[model samples]
Target chain A: MKVRVTVMLKEGVLDPQGKAIGHALHTLGFPGVEAVRVGKIIDLDLKSTDAQAARAEAEKMASELLANLVIEDFTVEVLG
Target chain B: MKVRVTVMLKEGVLDPQGKAIGHALHTLGFPGVEAVRVGKIIDLDLKSTDAQAARAEAEKMASELLANLVIEDFTVEVLG
Candidate 1:
């Protein structure tokens, strides 16, 4: 199975990297951009074939190591 | 309008960060993981109302600034 985990900073947290990217975009002539937020996408290839079990395992991985609970939130999705 | 740009290292490229993550997961007891790839997800809030225009703008941004074309590939998705 293939699984994906997305980890993002919680709202109300400042994201300097995102701010810098938005600024760079404006400098590069993309004036239509209003805001930007950056996050992590982890794609996993798992030996398990069951989608439900894979999702649960991915979620556990996120909670235990992939995310900082105080500042970040994560979501797990199972893909074929 | 909102747009998401996902940037990933091209296949065959070395990804030390991803390797480190996979090693850590293995040490943490996720023995079922076969491989892992890390990428970026950039969420953009655009002032434009037209989805088509927004997607085009985002693609331009991704090509010019968000992705390192020599090593990274990117995909742009427009969302409401």
Candidate 2:
């Protein structure tokens, strides 16, 4: 099975790296590029046979090591 | 308009950051987590009224500012 996890900073969280990227875009003449929020995408290949178990395991992975739950939120997508 | 740009390390490229994260996952007891490849997702709000133009512009943004073309690839998705 394949899974994709996206981890993003929650709203109202300060993202200095994202701000830097947004500034870079403006300097590169990308007009109307108001803001840029940068997040993470984690692609995984798992051997689990059950889809629900895989998702639950992946969610546990996300909460445990993949994301900073205090300031970030994550979503998981399972793919065949 | 809302757009999402995902930038990922190209195949065969060495991703030390991703490897470190994978190791961390293993140490945290995430069994069967074979590998973890980390990428970036950029969310943007644009003022463009045309969908095609917005996608093209966002692609340009990804190429010019969001992704390192030498070792990375990017995809753009437009959302209402």
Candidate 3:
């Protein structure tokens, strides 16, 4: 099974890296680029075949080690 | 308009960051986790309304500024 976990900084969280990227985009002449929020996409390959079981396990993985729950939020997607 | 650019390390490219994350997950007791590849998701809010144009512009942004073309590949997705 394949799973994707998207980890993003929650709203109101300061993201220096994203700011830097946004500045870079502006410098590169991308006009009208309002905001750029950068996040992580973690693609996981698991041995399990069950989608529900894999999603549950991946969600645990996200909460346990993949995300900083205090300032970040994560969503899990199970893909075949 | 909203656009998302997904940047990923090219195959055969060494990703120490991803390896470290995988190791961390293993230590945290995710036994079925086979592999983990980490990438970036750049969310952009643009002023344009044309989805096609926005996607093209975002693709250009990804290639020129957001992704390292030598070692990274990017895909652009336009969201309503």
Candidate 4:
């Protein structure tokens, strides 16, 4: 089984890196690029036999290790 | 207009952050998690009247700032 976890900073959080990228885009003549928010995607290769079990475990992984619940949120997608 | 850019490390590139996350998952008892790869997503808010032009400009932004073409690849998705 395979899983993809997407972790994003919560709304209202300031993203310095994203802001820097937006500024670079503006300087490069990409007009009207008002804002940019950056997030992370984690692709996982797993050897689980049960899809349901794998999803459960992956969610646990997100909460425990893959994401920081204080300032971020995450979603998990399973792919066979 | 809005654009989403996804940047990923090329295959065969070493990702220490991803490896660290994988180790954490393993320690948390996520069995069968063989590998993890990390990528980035950048969400953009643009004020373009033309979607086609917005996409083209966003691609250039990805090439010049959002991604390192030497070791990374990127894709852009436009949203109205």
Candidate with best DockQ: 1
Candidate 2 stretches greater than 4 Å from native: none
Cα lDDT for residue B69, model 4?
98
Better of 2 and 4 by TM-score: 2
- Candidate 1 ranges beyond 4 A from true positions: none
CA shift of B6, model 2, Å: 0.2
* TM-scores of all predicted structures: 0.98, 0.94, 0.96, 0.91
TM-score result, candidate 1: 0.98
Give the per-residue lDDT digits (tens) of candidate 1, residues B1-80. 99999999999999899999999999999999999999999999999999999999999999988999999999999988
Measured against the true chain A, the candidates' chain A TM-scores are 0.96, 0.94, 0.97, 0.94
Candidate 3, residues B1-80, lDDT tens digits: the string is: 98999999999999888888888888878878888898999999998899999998998898888899999999999887
Interface RMSD of each: 0.5, 1.1, 0.7, 1.0
Model 4 Cα lDDT, one tens digit per residue, B1-80? 88889999999999998899889888878768999999999999988868898898789888988899999999999987
In terms of docking quality, how is candidate 1 classified? Answer: high
DockQ of each: 0.95, 0.81, 0.90, 0.85
Tens digit of lDDT per residue, candidate 3, span A1-80? 99999999999999888888888888889877888888999999998999999999999988988899999999999888
What would the per-residue lDDT of candidate 2 be over residues B1-80, giving only the tens digit for each residue?
78999999999999888788778887878768777788999998777878898899999888877889999999999986
Candidate 3 vs candidate 4: the DockQ winner is 3
* Model no. 1, DockQ: 0.95
Indicate the residue-level lDDT of A19 in model 3: 86
Stretches of candidate 4 off by over 4 Å are none
